[model samples]
Target: MSKTFKFFIPCDKAHIVCDKAQYREASLWEKAKLITHLAFCKICRKYTKNNTKLTDKIKESQIQCLDRKDKAAMKKDFEKALKDYSN
Candidate 1:
């Protein structure tokens, strides 16, 4: 492929671009290449659609994680239980 006409990217690269776009990390050129790839690749288009839907659902869920202190306490408890079980 010519250097100037390198807009169409492979599926793997398109997937990475899609993920980066979801996280607002992909550059404008990468986005453009991904869009061009999606224009003709049905499979990639579906993959991008599913990825977008998954991202949207995650944002809507607003999931939370345990803080560092809570995680440390949980790990300590688990270790204590394992020690007891081994004895």
Candidate 2:
């Protein structure tokens, strides 16, 4: 059963932050209080340890080219084929 955590603080309210440790351990009150703490403190929010948010910029790079040895072998094969064709 999901436990409902209730914390009403002035300046910021109704902030819902899921606490993985408490939620995994089935502690609803702790999760609710964490949500409450996060609502007021940005520093605590920044330092919160969890894996949900991946804020890092990810880039997809692809390299399409032959390696040095393969390139050399291809060049040699092309040269041999050209020589055979000319003869």
Best by TM-score: 1
Taking all chains together, the TM-score of candidate 1 against the true structure is 0.93
Q: Report the backbone clash tally of model 1.
A: 0
Predicted structure 2, TM vs. truth: 0.32
lDDT for each of the candidates? 0.93, 0.54
Which sections of candidate 2 miss by over 4 Å?
A: 1-23, 49-87
lDDT of 1 at 28: 96
Candidate 2 deviates by what RMSD? Answer: 14.8
Which 10 consecutive positions of candidate 2 have the poorest summed lDDT?
Answer: 51-60
lDDT of 2 by residue, 5-57 (tens): 23543222222234344236525665667667777777556655332343221
Candidate 1 lDDT over 1-87, as tens digits, reads 688567778899999999999999999999989989999999999999999999899999999999999999999999999999999
